[model samples]
Target: MASDTASLRPMPAPERALARKRRYRRRLRSRIILSFVIFGFVLTALIASTAVYLRNRVEDQVISAALTKNNNVFAEGFYRNPDAIGVPFEKIQGRQFSTSKLDRVPDAWRALANGVHELTEQDPVTGNERVYRLAVRKDPDYWFFLAYDIAEERESQERLNRALIGSVGIFTLLSALIGWWSAARVMSPVSELARRLQASGDSTQPEPLAPHFPEDEVGQLASALDDYAARLTEVVQRDREFNADVSHELRTPLAVVKGAVELLLSRPDLDEKTRARLLRIQRAEQQCTDLISALLLLSRNERGHGATDVQRVAEQLLDAHRTQLGGKPLALRLEGSRELVVDAPESAVNVALGNLIGNAVKYTTQGEVIVRLLDGAVEVIDSGPGLSAEDAARLFERGYRGTHAEHSLGGGIGLSIVRRLCALYGWRVRVVPGEERGVVATLTFSAGNGTL
Candidate 1:
C-alpha cells in the first residue's frame, strides 16, 4: 500500500561543531604555512644561485690572471734557453709546447684556440687525477703552452657547493618554524573572535566584541558584527510584538465563531443539513486556531512539544474535507495505524499534515485521498494525476504552481509552509510519484528527543 520510505539521522551538536572548527583551522594553517614555505624556497634558490655565479666568476678571473702571469714567466724562461725547455719547470711538473699541435697532451686538450682551458688528467708518477689550467700563447717563432695545477681550487668549489646546499636545508626548516609561529600569532585573535561568535548564539543579548581586539581588520569585523546584532535584535523585537498582536486579534474572532456554532447546534429545530453545516463551521474555526498557533510558532522560530495522536488529527482533517466536498466523487479516508502518537504540539501536526491533506483533496477530482499513519511518519496519498518532473522538482518552492494548477484557486504556498514546518521540527517531508497513478506526500518525523 506504500511506494517507499526513508529515514534521517541527526548528528550530535558538539561533535558537529568540533568537526567544523577543525576543518576551518586546518585550512587556515595550511595556507599560511604553504605561503611562507614557497617564499623561503624562492629566496633561498635566488641567494644560492647568485652566490654560485659570483664564486665561479671570481675563481675564473683569478685563475685567468694567474695563468697569464705564469705564462709570461715561462715564455721568458723559454726564450732564454729554447733547447733546454725542461729546466725551467724543475720544481713543478710543468709541460712546454713549441708548436700549435699538442701531440703529447691528452686528446681532450688537443683543440686549444690560444686561451686558458682547464682539463683533468691522471698523473703517471702519482697515479692520481690532477686538474690543470692550460694557457696557450702564440709567439713569433713558436707556440708556448703552460699547465697550472688547480686541484685545490676544484676541492674548494665542491666544498662551497655542499655548504650552500646544507644552508638551504637549514634555512628551509627555520622558515617552516617561523611560519608556524607567525600563523599562530595571526590566527589567535581570529580564533578568539570565532569562539565569541559561537558563544553569543546561546545568549539573548550579545556583549560587545570590539573592546577585546586591537584596531585592525579583526576589530573592524567585530564592530560590524555589533551593528548587525543590534539590527537583528530590533527586527526580532518587532516580530514578537506583531505575532502577539496577531494571535490576540485572530483567536478572538475564531472563538466567537466556535461559540456561535455551538449555540446553533444546540437547537432542536435545526435540520440535518443545517446541523452538518454548523459542525463544518466549528471544524473550520478549530483549524484556523491551530493554523494561527502553528504560524506564530514558525515566525518565532521556536518549538513546543506535547503528546499528539497522528491518527486522530488525520481523521479530523478527512472529516472536515468530506463536509466541503460538495458533489465531487472524491473519498477522503484515514487508514493504517490507529494509535500512532508523536511528541509534537497538535497545532504543528495539524498545520503540516493539514496542508498535505488539503492539497490532496483539492487536486484529486474523482479518486480517493488516503491519510496513512506509520510508526513515525504520515503519508497523504492522492489518486490525482501523478506529478510531472517539473512539479516534483519545484513542488515545495514558495509561490510555485504545478502543471495542474492552471485554474486552481491557490497561491501555491501550502507545500512551502509544510516544508518550513518540517525543517523547524527536525522532520522530513518529501513528495514522489506513487507506484500506480498518484503522488504520495510523506512526512517522516525525527525519532530524537521530541518523538515518541
Candidate 2:
C-alpha cells in the first residue's frame, strides 16, 4: 500500500518551490543586476569611509600642532619670568608646574608623555562630558601642558558623517538604476534571439537568426543556433524517411508471411504439430507488424487515436506468452473488468501490454502471471522474485537491466519503450514489490484517455 501511494503522488510543494528559486537565480539578467548593485554599494562605502578617516586625521594634526606651539611659548615665558601669568586663550588652557610644585599638576595630566593625547573629562561648569586634546612637554625643571577643547570639531565631524552616509545611499540608488538599465540593454538582443528561436521551433522550417543581429557575442550565438537547427532538421528528416521506408518495406514481407500461414492453416488433415507451428507463425507475424507500427509512431513522436479494448489486448498478450512457455510449469490468467477501453492505437497498446506480460512470463519460472484489468488501469502481477530497490529506481532507463535479467536474452530497452509510450499517451506505469513475494506492474490511463 505504501509503494502504491508513493508511486501516484505528485511532486511536493517545497521541492517545486526550490526548483523555481534555482531557475530564478540562474537567469543572466538577474545575475548582472545583482553584480551592479553590489559593486555600487561596495565602492560607495569604501569612499565614504576614506573620507571620514582623512577628515579626522587632518583635524587632529591641526589641533595638535596649534597646542604644541602654544605650550612651548608659555613654558619659555614662564622660565624667563617665574611670576608670568598663564598663556591666554578662550578654548585653550596652558599650565606649568615647577619641580618643587609638581604635585599641583592634575593626576590625569601628570602621567602623560610628550605627545598629543585625547582625554574625556567632566565639565566643571556644565556637569557634562567634555572632549579635549592634551599636549604635554616634560623637563627636569618644569612640566608644561596644553589642553584644547574639541566639542565644536566633534559636532562638525558628526554632521559630515551623516552627510557621507546619505551620499552613500543616494549613490547606491543611482547604481541600481544604472545596473537595471545596463542589464536591459545587454539582454535585449539575447531575449529577441530566444523569442525568434522559440517561434521557429513551432514551425516546420525555422527562420534564420543570424541575419537579424550584428556580428557580436549574441549574433554569434544566434548563428550557432541556426547551424544546430539546420543539422537537427536534416537528421529529423532522414529519421522520418527511414521510419517510413522501413514500415513500407517490412509490411510487404510480413503480409506475405501472414497470407502463407493463413493459407496453410485453412487446409484440413494436417497434423497437430504442423497446425500448431502454423498458428505460432501467424501470431509471430502479427506481433512483428504491431511492433513495426508502434515503432513508427514512436519515431514520429505522434499518438494515433483509437478505441483499444484493454481487456482484449491483455488476453492476446497472455495467450502469446503462454504458447512460448514450452515445458515450464506456469499459468497465465486474466481477471477484472472486460469493458475498459483506452483512446490509443491498438499497436501501442499491444506493445505496452506485450512488454509487461513478457517480463512477467520471462521471470516467473513455475508460478502464475495474472493480468488484472481495472476501470482505467491494468496490472501485470507475477509470482516471481520481487523487484529490488535498485531495479525499481532505474528500470525504465534505456539499456538498464534488472538483477533478475542477468541471464535474459534482451538489450533491456523493452521497459524503456513502454515508458515512452505511456508518456506519449498520457498514461502512467510503475512497478513495485507485491504483497508477499512477486512484482506488480501497473499501467494507468488518465481520464479522457481511457474510459469504461
Candidate 3:
C-alpha cells in the first residue's frame, strides 16, 4: 500500500529558479482566461453581424418587388375602365398577387387633396404600409392612377425576417457558448500543468504532470517546459557541489591566517620593528577576511533577497554607519516620513556603501561626508577633489582608473564593485560635483517609499 501511494504522488525536479515559482499562478490563470475570452468575443460579434445583414436583405427584397408588381396592375385597371372609379373598391386590384393576400388590395384613396399621393399606397384594413415616389404623371381623362397593394409585401417580409432572426440568434448564442467551452478546455489543463511544474525544483521527487494533456500548442509548450525542468535539476545539483567546494577552499585559508597571526602576537620577545611588521600582516589578513565574508553574504542575499519591505533595511545600514563615524550624529531626511525600500538584496547596498564611504574618508581632508537616504536613493557627499563629468560617467567601471583616483590611495576597483552590485539589484548610480569642490555619489533605488 505504501509503495503504491508513493508512486502515485508526483516527483519534484532538482532545481527551479526562485522567481519563476513566485509568479507562476497569477501568470497562468491570466493566460488561460484571456485566450478563451478573446476568441469567444470575436466569433460572437462576427456571427451576429452576419445574421443581421441576412435578415435585412430578405425583408427588403420581398417588400420592394411586391410594390412594383402591384403598381403595374393598378395602372392597367385604371386605364381600361374609367367608369369604374365609383366601383374602385367593388373589384379590388391585384388581390391574387405574390406578396401579401391580406385586406382588399391596392386602391387610390384620396387624402384631403393638399399633397399628391405617391405611386405606393397603404391599406386602411390591415395597417400594412408601402412607400414609393411617383414614377410618372397621371392621365386625368382615363382616370388612370398607378398605385400598388403594399400590405401583403410588408407582411411577407416580416414573416421571413422573424424566421431568419429566430434561427440566427439561436445559432449565434449556442455557437458562442460552445466555442468558449472548447477554448477553455484547450487552455485549462495546460495552465494547470505549468502551475504544477513551477514547484518542481531540486527535490528528489519530480512533479508529475497529468498524463492526458491536450494535443495543441499548449501541450507542446508544457512538454518542452518539462524537459527544461529536468535539465535544470541537474544544473542545480552541480551548483550545490561547486558551492561546497568554494566554501571549503575559501574559509579554510582565512581561518589559518587568523590562527597564525594570533600565534605571532602570543610571542613575548618581539621588538618594535617585528611588532610593526606583524601588524601590517594582520591588516592584509583582515582584508582577505572581509572579501570572503562579503562574497558569502552576497551569494545568500541574491538567493533570498528581502521582501518588498525596504525601509527597515536602509535604517539598519544607516545605524551601522552612525556607530562607525563616532559621535557625529547622522540626521535622517527622506522626502517623507519613511525610508525608501526597493526590491534588492542587503549585500547590494553594503557593497555600494563600502566603496563610497571608504573612498570619501581616503580623499576628503576636511568635513564629514553626509550620507542621505530618500525615496529611491542613498547618497554620499564628501568635501574632496570634485570629479569632471567625463571622469564621473565612467568611474564605476572595473579597471577604469580615474584622474581623481590617481591622486588618492585608489585602484578604481571600489566603485566597480558598487556598479555591479547595483545592477544585480536593479538600482542605478550617478556621481556629480558637490556644493563645494567635492564629489557626491548617489544611488537611486528602483522604487520609492514615502517621498514627494
- In order, candidate lDDTs are 0.82, 0.86, 0.55
With candidate 2 superimposed using the best TM-score fit, by how many Å does residue 45's alpha carbon deviate from the native?
1.1
Q: What is the lDDT of residue 55 in candidate 2?
A: 87
Q: Provide TM-scores for the models.
A: 0.88, 0.91, 0.55
Error of 3 at 392 (Å): 9.2
Clash pairs (backbone) in predicted model 3: 11-205, 11-206, 11-207, 12-205, 12-206, 14-202, 15-202, 100-152
RMSD of every prediction: 3.5, 3.3, 12.9
Best by TM-score: 2
The best-first sequence of candidates by lDDT reads: 2, 1, 3
- Give the lowest summed-lDDT range of ten residues in model 2: 1-10
* Candidate 1, 76-145: lDDT as tens digits: 8778876655434422344565455456655665577678988888888999998888887766556666
Model 1 TM-score on a 0 to 1 scale: 0.88
Encode model 2's per-residue lDDT on 164-241: one tens digit a residue. Answer: 999899988888899899999998897788779867988878999999999999999999999999999999999999
Candidate 3 or 2, higher lDDT: 2
TM-score of 3: 0.55
Give the runs in model 2 whose Cα sits over 4 Å from its true position.
Answer: 1-25, 81-90, 448-452
Per-residue lDDT of 245 in model 2: 98
